[model samples]
Target: MIKTFKSSLFLCAMSALFLCSACHKEQSPIPEVLGEYLKYHAEKGKTADGYDAYFDLSDGMLAAYSNDTTKAEIKSIINKITGNKNCRNIYSLKEGTVSKLDKSQTELYNYILNPSSYATVAPIEETLKRITSQGTSAFLVTDFEEYSNGVIQQQNYAKAYFVDWLKKGGDITFFITNYLENGKQKHLYFTVFDMGEHSLLKDIENALEGSKSKYTRFNLTANVVDIEYGYSGTKGGCYHDESGEDIVSVTNESGEGDCFTLYKDYHAEYYPFNETWANIVKNAKDLSEEGNTPKFMHLITGPKVNLTSLSGYNVKELDLKVTNIQDDFIRFAGYYEYTKDKTINVDENGKLLDEYNYPNKNNATNMPEIEDMLKYAGCVQDGVATLNVDFDKDFNGTSSKVKPLDLLRVDIVIDECEPKYDLITKLFSWEGNNSLEQAVRNTLQEVNPEGQVIYTFFMRDGGE
Candidate 1:
């Protein structure tokens, strides 16, 4: 998932406001919005054991009116007192600690730290005062974070919907954080903007109404399992075998004898020695002519040891297998042998191995024509490759069906300077301000100035 944070316009406003009122005497504490948010966390009683900070507003204190100097001073004090540790779970709702905000603003604060983030259109102060904005329009802002953990851009898709709701005589603002954090089980934060005038009570009511809007939530748990394989030797044990009656063979106590002799006197069991059993005799001429008897052997009842655990055995030769035949998801579990002697240095001329790669062809014409060229744009399962070049229909219009056989050269615009034979989405992303096709055109001309760009344009066509 992309780990980017697309900032809403509210962030810009907040920055400007902070710079404006960062410094001043008789300053206030953390904004009431954040204060109330901390209070909520405190009330929940789930906050980790640490310093908990809060805030209260002073008279004539304006969140939008603070100077950078005062803000900096306050931040400095917070840094000095809290150091690197979080505020202990103590609610310090003081006016001079941080800027003061209103109850709705507090809700906005909660929304930010909550995964389900969105902005509203009511001044938090007015909301706290139980006032409402009549005949006023409000907007809900939704933002996204990118894969590189950067703010790419703020989206305004919700504005039209928000305006529609407002024009319908909606009297409240609702914000919610319904998504689960993806990593590190960290806290999520959001900032709700008061884009319109309205009463706090009505805002809450509206929020409640909008609570029925499409919402999604998720949580994840991690589980890990491990398995490993190895050899053993039996000491102070003599191999023995029980023979039938009538034959009582005897052997000296010195242990030198044939199998039958030892079986009767010393009760030695006659068993197959090893895998490469050449002869029962230790120094037979034919056995010597062959090779040394295998050292390690296997037996169902005899003393046996895992060869992997034995000394001098190369552990790297071991193999592992994992299979998932019945389950919602496939699983893999295995471990490598950790014997120190198993490590071996390879020559510099050794070739490196890879799991996946496209064929390195000299020219596109010589390459095999992919059944679906779009599917193998960059040779991987990238999404951008599958983008259809034919203009099937206009997307921006009311009609949803694509006109049959309407083929046009589509110049899919994207952020990439070079068109890769990868999946459509991976090859190029239309994440920035320009249209995908436009971006593609600009990038294409830059790369191939002499050749004409071959592609169709994506548009609603207005005919739908």
Candidate 2:
């Protein structure tokens, strides 16, 4: 009996040990796939509402430029807008007032053909001011030539109004159509103001397809950077399956809020997080006299990393490790920087527990000396534009290794993203010497000094 009792106790001890081991295994952290995280955050632009149509019946537009092609284009525009059920109102901008005109084709055609039947023309600024006041997406047809007193003042006012509109998330597209007027080249402007959430500009662009018009779309809204993972020739444990497309999950390390587990024995030949410029405006016609197409650089400034849940990190020592440095990484390495010292409290699940003052400035006080460590790589070469992460050397020229189960939280903050000034100048300027055209160009340069953040996404290291 004593032997049997001893044996039973030993068996119970072994059973308890097995159960505890099973529980420990169950509690182990599992990594999350990086591709799944990106797929989850990928969003599409929202569709906008209808549009309002406006036509300028000014004397300059009626008297100076009346030709068969011009009239056909005007008629096509009017007919297209009126035919669409989404077109809400048609207004004739003349006589210093915005008069509501019938949406019928006959009425609009008659008004266009017989300028004498209409009242005297008003300043073009009046029509622009009315569009600004209504705060809706609109389509306007005009000559863009202001022939009135205080042209500078009118241009300034128009610039101020449009700048405010752009600041509040608005976009503009200028369609310049050229026609022959008695052997002299003449131009007419068809402008689209995309205010609020109305995106009728694309529809109008589609309507004018195959027509002889030059397009310059000014999207003043913040540019959303596109993050693509597992780019071409990517390898290692980042992927989840044999297909090599889906990424593995990033798991938190030991329930620590900040520390994470990426993967074991992971070495990427190419950096996984590749960023590309979004919402690039493609001009329809090359207006350069030298036949040189304007090259654009999407300058990304003030990039920093932050915790997904917390406002900032509070750790004393932070290290960045980069291996396999490439030559292209040295070009744009100045843009990446580390965050300054800040106190943050997060829960075990990586949720913010206390309120912290988030840094708002562009200058980072504590920066890592990782010159040529990582860069915003890729540019237009041979008519192809590519942007990605290409890092070839070690951080600070010192070899720092990423151990197994180390998780990194990369938050790419794009403070300012815009094209170089040369592109902006080419897009806004025209062939004629018009003061309003120059003013519009100046306003574009001033307002677009620093582009806004059109997109925001987070990246993590590790996968299950």
Candidate 3:
């Protein structure tokens, strides 16, 4: 059976390299980033949840191998230090390659430095060697390592041993799972931390309690964690109060005392562009009114799925809007709105644009496979415009199999240019196989050729 890699859970196994190293000296300074992550987990538990610790030894190794610096000679030194005449076990080399000083060596070195760039069938180190042996750019492939149990233990030891290493500066982030293999579910927990303070942790706790996602449901009890307590076995799922009783049933799921919220707290931190886009829109309106300047408003459009509480439940369509109002910033917001109908002209000889077509997408939804779920509407104006969509009926289904057709469609209208905005719009199509979120990214990239993307995932249901 194929394991469903839920977007919210089950990360592709990345290398165990990011973890701390146990073989380090006690006086060595800990990488501040790892420390912040640990503190966040201990205090907040938001982003730090389920994160296997990693210590980046690549920088040190690279420094040792630098061409100019004679401060350290890594290869020969390490070879003799192991004292094993056999280099095979000490260093994993590429196939058909006996030495690390061959043409593939540079490729392997690049892969080791940036393992995240390549897709490796094995850990970063082993995978890099394999790819390099094929006489190709390691950058040409995907390389990520799924941390193993041994890696996890090494990480723990690094944290324990390298207390000084963490004294350096770094930041922390966390991820929360909608569901794990175990039936454990509760208000989502996450945390962020810095060298000087633990407020990020506190903020994460608060966000968890205040998160709008229904998946953030916690159990109640002393040893048990929940958003609702006291009334689970007695009253209904929600907590209730007695008539002026000195002591009421201790069932208050919203963290009766001292509980923190995850999303509510870190929402701004994660979604920095919320106000940035709003401000841009407001400024554009003011400018337009003052000078009658014709400004272009672009909304990068795409699909949104509301997978909140999908276990034996139903939901409604979740509407989303992506607006780029300012320079180098974009905002993606989820809402409840009527699905808008949009039509675009495709000539009798229509050719797909390369920009809108994201080639590496493994999860692209085919039109035929989702024919019942999606509806193809028109090729109007003598084949000038074609419209098709798949929408969520209520966005209430537990799986994507039962969503409404025409759920989300956005037209990014460029407002101003020496070149006509219409000319730019013609260069791209809102209807494509890419997800709504990706569509937004593509649209924004066109508007600001140099702009960076800032995306946020949200879900809004009016029925609630």
Candidate 4:
């Protein structure tokens, strides 16, 4: 009877050990993934099949370009356009009509110089609509001075269309030339619309090198900024992975491998290592004639910590607070919860599934709202912005310590960047302006209210 009881006890112990091993296999730790959707790749410029050139035959435009030098500049622009190894079309733009003209330079010049022969005024909005409808890149030469029934143009009718074009990811390059029209200095604009990845604008820019013209180019392309971990080699006991530009592994000097420990008293500050402030100053100086400093606003969102691995630790809630050391920079923080029902789907190799990708959650609904936690004044000095992240914030007034072996997959995004350059103000004249100023201002304000994401960073925190 005693021998039988001993064998039964040993079998029971073996069964318990097997069950424990199976549970451990099922609860594998989550892997750290960063920068899944932060980088922006710009479409490369290519040569188009053909291009269109439109000349406004209005009296103002004809008179502005009638000078020998200005006329030569116009012909130079046309020659550059036709110089390409593709068919080019020239058209006379007037009063909601685009009539094809002879490709001959003499005929084109004759048609452009004789304003009285074609005395109809072209509606700017109609011309823009025509260009947009064609869905092809084109050049528009005009004085941009509008007349309605021989009255001064009052309202900006083309503002809405320009805004629409900009919002649709189109780019515009304005080549402004100054000339004396009727003994007064006037401006003639050569506007190029780039609807796709075409090298037309660059070609024109190259062709007009050393020419007396000022140009301004604007596009809806994403502006990405570089970021680094820590300030002045002070990583606060953390190390950055050289393979990833945005990855930060939180480990001490003695720690080895991917995971490391963060004690309760862990604290650190990171600075934007790039020449952001210097560039701001340079951009303002280069673009501004009035020496006015440009203004930029930053919108910080989401350091979404994937707390899937912390489930075994009973981590009901975790609070990660980011404080801005400067008042000029916005102050915001986030609180995260470990949802037991939410299981991240991963493949056999531990890579996240397509639906569960990181840094791609750009939808505002998926982002956590900013709650009142802590505020620290950040500072900008020596052309660098310093920001601090405190991990020791108390949770539920009970625990302020991050549990050992806990893994935090932190993903932070920076978006809605507004870098208002003074060049915009210098682009158009407001005094007795012929709707250009109003149109430009309205379009800029409407289309770019909240700029796109400029940077996204990923960080991981683990306990020993």
> lDDT winner among the candidates?
4
TM-score of each: 0.13, 0.52, 0.17, 0.49
* Candidate 4: regions farther than 4 A off: 1-51, 83-88, 105-118, 214-426, 430-432, 455-464
Order of models, best TM-score first = 2, 4, 3, 1
Indicate whether candidate 1 or candidate 4 has the larger lDDT: 4
- Model 4 C-alpha lDDT per residue in residues 100-172, reported as the tens digit of each score: 8765756666667665646577666677787776656778888666667876576877676676665665666
Cα deviation in Å at residue 364, candidate 4? 14
Candidate closest to the true structure, highest TM-score: 2
1-464 per-residue lDDT for model 2 (tens digits) = 00000001112212221212322221111122232223222212222467788777766566433766666667767767876877888887676677788747877777776768455554567777776776677888876555455232334446766676555456666676665445645556788888543446667767677665454444433221222333232232122233333222221223232222232112111122221111111111112124533321222111222211111111122222222211111111111111111111223443322221112233322323233434544332322223333333333312232221222222222323333445434444444444444556556556653322222222222211
- Checking candidate 4 for backbone clashes, the offending pairs are 261-464, 324-378, 325-377, 325-378, 326-377, 326-378
- The sequence of per-residue lDDT tens digits that candidate 1 reaches over residues 1-464 is 21111111112212221222222211121122222322332233122222222222222222211333323323332333232243222121122232222333335244223322212222222222221222222222121121112333233322333233323323222232322222211111111222222222233233334233232211000000011111012211212223311111111122222111111111112211221111222222222343434321111111111222111111112111111111100000000010111111112332111110111122111111112111101110222122122111222211212221111112222222233223212222333522222332333233321221111121111111
Model 3 residue 76 lDDT score: 23
**Each prediction's RMSD to truth:** 32.0, 16.7, 27.0, 16.6
lDDT of 2 at 115: 60
- Candidates' C-alpha lDDT: 0.21, 0.41, 0.22, 0.43
For model 3, residues 1-464, the per-residue Cα lDDT tens digits are 21111111101111111222332211111112222323343343122221111112222122222322111122222322233222122222222122322214344344444434222122333433332232211111111112354331122211211122122222322222222213322111121222233333333344344333332221100111112111222122111224311111121223322111122121110111111222333433343343432322211112122222121111222222332211101000000000110111112244222211222244233431221221222222311222112222332122332121111112211122122234223221122212212322232233231111111222111110
